[model samples]
Target: MTARLDSVEPAVRDPIRIDFEGWSIEARAGETVAATLTAHGIRGLRATRTGADRGVFCGMGVCQDCLVEVDGVPNQRACMTSIDRPLRVRRQRHGQALAAEVTALPPATAESLRTERPDVLVIGAGPGGLSAAIAARRAGAAVVVVDERRYPGGQYFKPLAVDGEDVAPPDAQHREGLALVRRALEAGVEIRTGVMVWGAFAPAEFTASDDRGAVRYLPKAAIVATGAYERGWPVPGWQLPGVMTTGAAQTLWRTARRLPGRRVLIAGNGPLNLQLAAELLAGGAEVAAVVESARPGARHLGALVAMAAAAPSLVRDGIRYHWQRMTRGVPMIDGMVVAAIERTAEGLAVTLKNASENGGHRRFEVDALCIGYGFEPSNELLRALGCRHDFDAEQNRLVTRRDGDGRTSVAGVYALGDCTAMGGARVAAADGAVAGYAAAAELGLPLAPALEREREAAKKQGDRHRRFQRALWTLYRAPPYRIEQASDDTIICRCEEVCFGDARAALAEGVIAAGPLKRATRIGMGPCQGRYCRPLLEALLAQGSDRQPDEHSGFAPRVPVKPIAIRDLASASD
Candidate 1:
């Protein structure tokens, strides 16, 4: 049975009935299919080939496990597909759909696949892109901002479904992001939502597509602020239906205004975990515990002091979060790491190891497990554009190389937000403003004295945030590599159903890099296109074989960054 709180409010009043496996569920208009189903006690949306149930893992389109047959269209992302009308949604049984399953979409005409040219093309509508667009417009440049989501806030200030219910952000961070959106619109930024940028090509070209058709964007200068996705770490039984990333659970609460579960266990290393705990508690969910993998010690003192000095606001925010947890009597256990998750008849049995106590074990039974290790920059689009990459050893990821002003190695291309560096939204916005200012200045838009002052201030703020982030990284370092805890039966790639044993055997057979391993086991070639499994697989390969991540820098991403329907591609040809 699914646990839902009575405190939750639907985004729409007049209900649109959606059929899920023959069960009629009342869904709101602005809510996604996943939100609608999960709210109605339907978490298991699909079954894997191994017959294990899968639910909303990432709550975004990155993890394709939420694919459901929507109105006869198989493999449609339930989270990205909003419920505008009554529809028939069915559980995709082991990737199978009925023979009669078909949805006829109108063919795309030349006019539909319209091409536009702007002075500046911003690839994301989040804080970064919005700030960039606003600055460019201030400098008398025609700016266009594109985002895949139907809304303008991106992930940081993602507003709750505002079509039916008035859901305001409960926190100041997100509130500020909403305010940025307003400023950008008032500054005459052309914000295009529901457009997916699939590829970036030579001479500043971007190929994007939406339901209407494919669109091409050519711009004098471009800013890539595509943002980042949640990083997944391997633990036994992590593939369970109820186990999801903290980002996923946060989306359920923040964007959808729905609780993930009645009893939730949040484990990982970061401020995001603490913030999630507070949100879950406010949403009336029972937070069992917040198990932090990093142990706070004397070693963290220097970094903490440095961080506090660099960003006092961040320090104050941290103290407030601590106070919230303490006042609510929520146990925030540092020096504890998740060892494994065991399936229980009721929900799940989570085994945690005390890092400070010689790996002593304790078990907690909870209905949901939300894990957040850290974030990896979603830098595929930048890499695709031939942007140089530097391996960030501390983070164990390849981030796109950028100057202080967010200019990439490419002359006309710039990068901001988490794609350039994993600084939070504020840093992204600051860097984006600077990028916009510099780009506009280079494009012959004379920077006013006041604009120059603002740009310098933003640059200074971004630098300070960068220092804070470096200190935070040192203080909250990831736990010692623990891939050994993954049992042989543990599944690594949900899309391909490849287990640890399979990956190990493939590695033993001289599959050293992500590309070879993927070709051998068909691991990253699935619907997600390596978004979910590549990081885990890369780590597994490095740990299994004594090779550095740079030795095999993962599989190179192809065009159509997100999966596009064949019909859409064919329609573009027409």
Candidate 2:
């Protein structure tokens, strides 16, 4: 028997009500406060002084879009947050005062006494992040750099192994990153790898809990260079174990030195896919196909041409290599999309639908599917701080408005790197340097004319890259048909194992919002959390409930911001 909405009695759930600016909502037991507010049509729970209304975009704790003040704490990600107890909620537009209030009263324990305030706190140890820390320390600021990864490098400088031993190679990008790490350490930058900054509150205090345990960092200013993640795309069999994002696959190969499969099919739109494919092929993996969704004469041709002209050698080499593969009868399917993937006895039989042919389909047997569209800014921490964002419809990114030097709307807070906007690694590092100097200047340090000159150079380089990125984005935009291709049985949220059917059922039960459905279905509460799945879930639920994707309310804000290890907390003195 199917479980009907009314047949299942509403569990005697505790009700937590939040009163926002001119709005009010009640969160059911175990529901996130953000989700609860979103369920009740509170789209603009917070508004900027410019009157720009904002809410959660990425339901994952990564994109900080759904930050709100809970009982005086500013910048808590509403997605990972739950309303376990009664609390006050407010809309914050700027400053860390409200955010600081929340952290001031974090259920204090014995370990809380050890919390040390630094002069400068840097979240994320990527090229930009590490550079910023090193620069700040050299400028006489007491600096502390925290990162979630096991090592210093963020995305650009990934750790790799050689000869059964983990060695930082001098030629590797991460080796460059290692140099920054070493410099920062030598310059007295306290580095804490494997630590995640869960919250950034007012009075320049940030909460980071990791292997050592939860610690409060009270810095004069903060630098956020958290970076970006691969955008999620919906397709059949995407939930399969062997199927992963191109970035994830690269991480596996680069970091763990593990092949995704014996035979791999790389698909999606972007230069990253091609670059990754070439890397995989060079790494001795059989690339069965490189399926791209873009048509040859699509828009953004100007930018593509410019890129080809600028990097003639790279373009020539890429063309030469791909031509060789094609001459050897290797499959390179353009204007095609993966329709379905079925696990066969041998491997994965991927059904290909070619747009050029009517009702035309082809199949390829491969062991893995490496898929990704592009990158999206990971802004959860910033959003939690109540920073404002604008939806860049072209790139499909919710970008925070920042000064020329990467200062966000919030004073004393700065954002740089791919986290601000998806420029490549070079742009990220350059932006980090600019932000570092700008932040120091903001702290009353004299500005060097050379630093301003470097900023101008960085801006020009960034502009060029951004133009190329826009063209690339247009080239690799997810086809409209991909959304229509989702099967009713397809599971969107792998963490909660929630399928399209479950999402529809939630809508039918009057959930009709992203927040409530999350609680009812646990759609965004998994290991990777909603980092990869939130956008898909949002689109699915919006369609199911007959609401525009952007119109849907945001997620609830919660604390203990990042996932903490039980052992780490247990080891901390009470």
Candidate 3:
């Protein structure tokens, strides 16, 4: 029921048949293995070591939950691996040994490493990273932007279809990204999409890899705008197939034009859930219910006024989303949260409990469950590069300590977008431009007076968006996060399958910080590098200690923040 609003309906071009689990499935060129599987109702992609069913939880490459076997190569992330030809994809099961398979694989080669010297290195192709690159390039710096995503727009500016070359962008976000990316390219910015920036040794020393091999970047200055991932809530059966973050569902729908299921139950805190619900409904998917943790009402009139003042179009968009929900007869279950989820023959049986004044529980049998509880910044590279950070008690996450112009504590290094703070795309774009101009000025690059004037405008735009973000959150404010509500048996780490009880026992044994607790219980030892569980672990610690976790409570940023092939890592050595 979920697909692009293009010729995808009638038929597609250059289609290929994939032998997935002995069933021949139709797929499109450039379509992700995850999308191809889900389009035909193939949910259970793999099994956890504990025999628990898993699917596309994070959607992006952050979570390794969607690993599958691709042509005998076990543990390939279906979401990250795209196929343009015929292939065999198998479900990776529990206790499936890769030792023999590993030996069968090809070895690493030094030729995989390509050294590049650039004036500015932007570690993301998203709004912020592209903006920085564009500005730096225009100011006479040789800029190279690297992003892990196949498309250059990053998550917010995600392209409409996997094979949408003939199709126009479905929305204004993609259009905007297209325009910005075009401007960056015109300004001589070297954008290397499909490249994963894995490690940062020095301020501007970075190692990245692609399908072919690895590349080492030595830039004079660097901007770490790796962006953020969807924050997760650890509910029971959350790891089940068809249960995923709102962003993951959006990615599938937007990029691959595939819905997780025919009917979806969208839940959790923040405006994203609402926006996603509207998008899915527009895409012809039946929304079972929009379970929101917040109850926006007239009591937040001041915030509404500020939001309208800051971004009237966005406010109107929010209204439009609600109007669509109403017109579509979609249930907008506000002041509630997904309490539990269980598998059903038809789909998933979801239980919604009241988190606010709406004191009631509702049940729904839906094909999929989309849960997005805001986001956590992907600041591993920034932190790894020794940029300072602080715990924002209000937001309940760690934020990068940076100047107004995006200057980090380390010289020649910058940060922008939600990676620094969870401001929206508008905020990121505006702030990125300012940082770019600042970087240019610092590098002694010639900045025309017109560009300086535009920089001032960018600063103003950033201010307005910041104000809008504040007011928007106020309008969508939810109750405090209660990690204790999660059952003791709830799995906290999807990678390691560590449960709440395990962490509780570890805390009982005198481990309070993330590092010690991670070792004691092996919680954050997952492939995601604690991007999903770090906040939960800190919350768990706070619940037990009766105090909030400090900035240090999050795991220390390590080398190869994202999972890199051993071959790619070895090739990084000059």
Candidate of highest TM-score: 3
Task: Using TM-score as the measure, name the better of candidate 1 and candidate 2.
Answer: 1
Q: Mark the regions of model 1 whose C-alpha exceeds 4 Å error after superposition.
A: 1-13, 95-113, 162-170, 297-299, 355-358, 544-546
TM-score of 1: 0.92
Q: For candidate 3, list the clashing residue pairs, or say none.
A: none
TM-score of each: 0.92, 0.73, 0.93
lDDT of each residue in 1-574, candidate 3, tens digit only: 1111232222345888999989998887777999989989889888877787789988889988898999988778999887868999999886765465344555544345678878888888888888888888877888878888766778887775554454334687767877887788778887776788877776657777876677777777888888888887778888889999999999887787777888999998887888888888877799988888999888999999999999999989889999999999988877888878899989899988888534498899999999998888888888778888888878877788889889999999989998888997888888888888888888889899988898889999999999998898888888865776778888899888999999988888888777888888888887777878888887777773567665556677788788876656554442
Q: Write the per-residue lDDT of candidate 2 for residues 422-450, one digit (tens) a residue.
A: 77776677677767777777788775676
lDDT (0 to 1) per candidate: 0.80, 0.64, 0.82
* Lowest-sum lDDT 10-residue window in model 2: 1-10
**Candidate 1: tens digits of C-alpha lDDT, residues 20-54:** 87888887677789888877767788877877788
For candidate 3, give the lDDT. Answer: 0.82
Per-candidate alpha-carbon RMSD to the true structure: 4.7, 15.9, 3.9
lDDT at position 186, candidate 2: 72
